[model samples]
Target: MKPEQLQASGRRTLEIERDAFAGLLERVDAHFAEACTLMLGCHGRVVVTGMGKSGHIGGKIAATLASTGTPAFFVHPGEASHGDLGMITPQDVVIAISYSGETAEVLTILPLIKRMATPLIAMTGKPASTLARIADVHLDVSVAKEACPLNLAPTASTTATLAMGDALAVALLEARGFTSEDFALSHPGGSLGRRLLLRIQDLMHTGDRLPRVAPGTPLTAALLEMTQKGLGMTAIVDADDRVVGVYTDGDLRRSLEDQIDLRSATIDQVMTRGGKNARPDWLAAEAVQLMEKHKITALLVTDDQLHLQGVIHMHDLLRAGVV
Candidate 1:
């Protein structure tokens, strides 16, 4: 086939899917709201079930719901007939998906699901099909046409189904007041979790690894501490171990320009007073933002009372993938 023909085929697929999505949006109505309400009010998990291609879409919907604060799981309709129906509880909400609303595997378990009296939400292209008639709520995810040229493949219909599932998940997420922190808890291993939930206390250098010295210590001694700790900076603390100021390589350069004798000058005289500081509980990503805003490489972690707790450097954040 010619390249132009291949391009035309791809364009046709996109146009079909786009129109299908537009149709879904136009069909959104009270049924969608009823489905959301049923799932939100459910005391137990949302049990999603489908057969064949619908099963794949149901699996993704379950995952999206679970991650977005709606507790949900997928059960294959075929398996449900073979005893997996036990997973469904009366307190739970059941979502059944079938483009035709008459998949044999799914329809076979409808009686058992009804016997349990679980709230049923049916997603189907046919609004007047048997499944829709029996379900407590019917969400119409109908598409005008299939993306495939032959009009037989599950293309545009599945896309519409998936988008509708996302709409439910996001709507429920907002209704539940789910925050970024809540999302981070569900995705602790991901980069977004690290950026939102990981704190300075979790990544900062603490205890002996923290570069610190008495305020009156010689500038030369503070430099040695900075070099030994490898943080490129040292916290100048008072007798009570409260940070009074900070000395960094930047201060050392300025002191040299002023021709101050490092061996004789005290840390209190050379240190930058009231330098940027963060709380141990502050998010590491926030600390990174602060550092970038001030164009500094290090920040002393302190408590509300200004007691030194730890030190965070750009290197530490970079190593932790917060940078």
Candidate 2:
């Protein structure tokens, strides 16, 4: 094919698939709500199964459901005919996917699923297909035509199925009040997880690692503490260990301009009083927002009493992949 022909083919495929996906918007009717209600009320896992291209789409649907708050897993229809049928229990809900809705592998297990009294949700293009007729809830993922020129491949059909699966997952997610933090619990291995799950106390420096000085400590001593702790700042605390002020490198620059004796001046005399602070329980991502709002790199972690518990820096957020 010529270059222009290849480009035209790709564009046509996208347009067809886009329309197929858009078609699902009108079909999100009472049946869709019923399917969501059944899955939400299920006491056990949502077992998803399909055949061929539909099987691939089923696996993705199962994964989205599992990650978003609904507990679900994919079981191959062919495997279900064997001992894997034991995996489905009466308390669970089963979701089966088939474009034709007459996949022999899927049909073979219907009698067993019915015997167990497990609720079956079928996703198919044909509303009157045997699987749809037998299922407790039927989701119509029908598309008018295939994106393939020969109209044989599963292009637009599979795309519509996947979009329908996503719609279900997101709707169920909202119904369950599933938050980002809840999602992070299931997806705790990546940067997205770190930003959502990580807390200030988890990454903040505490104890000896904290740079601090007595209120009347000399400017040189505070600078030394900042250098030793490598936090670019030192907290000045009262006798009760409550933070009274903060002295950073920026303060040091201003002190030098005033020609204040670094050896003679006290940290309290030059420190910025009442620094921006965050709670230890706050998310590290929240800390990033606070820092950006205040235009500061570090924040002192404290309790309701403003007693210093720890300190967090922008560099720490960067290393933790929360920045």
Candidate 3:
């Protein structure tokens, strides 16, 4: 085939699949809501099964559901006949995918599923087909035509089915009030998990590593503490070690412009009063937001009484993968 012919074919496939999804938007009605309701109320996992291409889509849908607060797993129809059906319990709900609604491998297991009294949801192109008629809820994912030139390949139909599966999972997610924090719990290895789960105390510098100075300390002395701690900033605290002000490198630059005597000027005289602070339990991600909003690089971690507990720098969030 010519290059132009391949490009035209690809465009035609996208157009057909796009139309398939347009049709699906109209089909999301009562049955779709019923399917979500069943899955939401299910005491056990959702058992998804399909054959051939439909099986591939079923696997993706099952994974999406599992990762989004729903307990679900995919089981091949062929494998189900070979005793994999034992994995299904009476409390489980089955989502059977068969575009034609008459896949033999899937149909063969219908009797056993029915015997267990498990609720079955069908996603098929033919609403009148056997699988649809037998299922407790039927979601029609029918497409008008295939994207394939020969009309033998499953193209637009599979796309429609996948979109419908996504719709169901998202609907169920909202119904369950699943939050980003809950999602992070299920996906702890990813960047989103780190941002949501990491706490300020987990990455902050404490004890001797924290740069702190007494309010009466001289600017020269505070600068030495800042250099020794290597944090570019120092907190001015009272006799009880409660933070009262913060002096950063920026303060040093302004002090130099005024030609102030570093040995005579006290840290409390030059420090920025009432610095931005975070609690130990505050999320590192929230700290990053506050830093960006205030255009600051560091946050002092404090207790309820404003005592300095530790300090967090922007670099700490970067190193901890919390940014």
Candidate 4:
């Protein structure tokens, strides 16, 4: 195809789906709420079943629900008769998808699902189809036209189904008060999990690895601690072990320009007092913003009484994928 033809075809396809989505918005009324309520009240999982392209969208919807704090998973309608039907329990809510609403494989298991007293929610383009008539709740995902030039491929219909599934998942998620931290719990291995779930205390270096010095310590001695700790800085604490100031390499350059005696100058005199510090419970991502906003490489983690808890550096954030 010509480049212009390709561009025109893609835009046309999007316009069709856009209109379908607009139509779908109108159908999200009481019936949709009923479906959401049913799924929410289900004691067991939301078992999604579909055939062909509908199955693909159903599987994705199940995954979205599962990750968003709802206990859900997909089952193939084609495989339901082959002992997979045991996966469905009476307490489970089944969402069956078929644009045609007449897929023999899906309809084959309806009697069995009904006999088990399972709630059946149907997502179909044809309202009068057998599957839609049998469902306890019918979700109308009918689209005016397919994006395909021949009107044979499932385009707008499938888009509508996916959007409807997302709508259901989100409604249930909101009703359940699912927070980002809860989502992070389900996705601990992903980047979002790392950002939302990881805390400053989890990555900060503590105990012997912490670079600390007394406020009365000589500036030269503080520098030795900074070099040994390799954090490019050291926390200056008071007798109560509270951070009074921090002496970084930046302070040394300014002190040297003034020709101060590193061996005689006390750390309290040259260190930056009231430096930015974080709490151990603070999110590491939050610490990154604080670091960027203050233009600092490291921060001292402290408690309510300003007692030093640990130290966090830019390298630690990078290693933890906080950035």
Candidate 1: C-alpha lDDT: 0.92
Candidate 4 lDDT over residue span 52-159, tens digit each: 999999999999999998899999988888999999999999999999999999999999999999999999999999999999999999999999999999998999
Off by over 4 Å in 2: 1-3
Top-scoring candidate (TM-score)? 4
TM-score of each: 0.94, 0.95, 0.93, 0.97
Residue 92, candidate 3: Cα error in Å is 0.3
What lDDT score belongs to each candidate, Candidate 1 first? 0.92, 0.95, 0.94, 0.94
- Span of 10 residues, lowest total lDDT, candidate 3: 260-269
In candidate 1 the C-alpha lDDT for residue 8 amounts to 95
Which regions of candidate 3 deviate over 4 angstroms?
Answer: 1-8
Worst 10 contiguous positions by lDDT, candidate 1:
22-31
Candidate 3 RMSD to the correct structure = 2.0
By TM-score, is 1 or 2 better? 2
- What TM-score, to 2 decimals, does candidate 1 have? 0.94
